[model samples]
Target: EEHPDNPGARLFLGLTLAQVGDLDGASREYKESARLAPDDPFPHYFHGQALHTLDRLDMAIREYREAVKLAPQDVRMRLNLGSAYYEQGIFESAIAQYREALKLNPGDAYIHYNLGLALADQGRFEPAIAAYKESARLNPTDPLVRYALGVVQETKGRVNEAIGEFEAAAQLAPTMAAAHAKLGWLYYNKNQVPQALEHFEKASRHDPDDAQTLHGLGLAKLASGKKDEGILSLKQAYQKEEREDKKRLIRSVLVKVGALSH
Candidate 1:
């Protein structure tokens, strides 16, 4: 009560509350701090952080915008604002903020990766590929960058290139279930049953609940003449699959194998 007019005191209280995981208390203190010192950007910035942590992206974006207005040259604020916009599906706004952040800190691999994600969300695959490439160049050991590059290549119908990227990603991060699953899928499409089986088994080992991996494993088993095992795997995949198209595909296979009535 004695420090009613003290913005710094309120700000300090907010920080303490945040440190103790009292998000609602921290938020109230931050609001009071901002009210006491409307010109100070720190309160708004901290408020944005709290909101973002709570997954209140709309409110976070608004607070971040206020912080940006108060400190336009702050690169970290721009990045945070861009991330908030990305979370809200405002890809163009995110791109603009990411571009500005890149100009301020060109060597930031995460900024490039985020720019790629925004461009990908807009379906601008060509530029998205370039951004992901730059991010991979800057951060070579990052398996997610390699995986994203693989996905874009696949989307562009460059199956061979996508296979290469997925292979590298799988090698770099052996436990990455998605990379192994992608490799299995590509091999299956190429009619390389043995190779597909190898990757599918690895993928299933990493994520036993993955329907797509189970589907691939079933097909590869059938191709290798393991009819009973293949039927079991297909049944499991059908049970686990939630997507309509995938379920239809699994049904078609079950019918072809005489496991289901036509």
Candidate 2:
């Protein structure tokens, strides 16, 4: 209730709403803050954060860029800008911004994680692994980073190491669907079909609507000699899936199991 025209108070109100996960309210406050003082950068920066939370990636990018222009020396803004680019599928641009931020804050674990994602998108497996390793070193408690590293390790054919990372990730974050899925895949690749099925079941249980987990469960069942049940689950996953890529994943599972029928 500071003066209605106080840009700083409006900015703080916007940021407070953002911290509480009220994206729309935060955006409204930020809009008012921006209008109150167009020269101030905090409103625009937090506005970008609110828009990003709402999945308005393009608008978030524009706002973040404006924030960067207003406060060109703020490395954190550059990092936020990089993440916005990453979410929008601009990997190279994301990397560029992240590295710039890194120049200003070399030890930021989140930057390492974001850099790893950009590198992985480019198929630069070695660099991605290095980046992920650095992030894991810097932030050992973050299960999401561990899970991402495990998935990348699996993609690079390091099955045993991947399994270790996935199991650790699962232990740290029991609710992480991706860790369960990766662990299941790791077990499957090691010829431990029963173990694979157990993990797949866990993954699917945690995220029932995840078609990939369902398909994974189906694959594990098939590999363990339950073809009929496997095919049924695969068929369900195929029908329930929404994205084209996930549909393709279901089809691949079906092919591996030798059918796509009722």
| Top candidate (lDDT) | 1
Residue-level lDDT of model 2, residues 1-262, one tens digit each, is: 6658988888888778878888898898898899999988888898998888888999999999999899877998998899999888899989999888888888989889989999999899899999999999999999978888888988888888889899989999998887888788778878899989999988988988877777878888888889998898788888888999988878987876669532
lDDT of 1 by residue, 142-189 (tens): 999999999999999999999999998998999999999999999999
In model 1, what are the clashing residue pairs, if there are any? none
The predictions' CA RMSDs to the true structure, in order, are 1.5, 4.7
Off by over 4 Å in 1: none
TM-score of each: 0.94, 0.71
The top-ranked prediction according to TM-score is: 1
Which residue segments of model 2 deviate by more than 4 Å? Answer: 1-39, 50-59, 209-211, 222-262
- Candidate 2, residue 172: CA error in Å? 1.5
lDDT measured at residue 5 in model 1 versus the true structure, 0 to 100: 85
Worst 10 residues of 1 by lDDT: 1-10
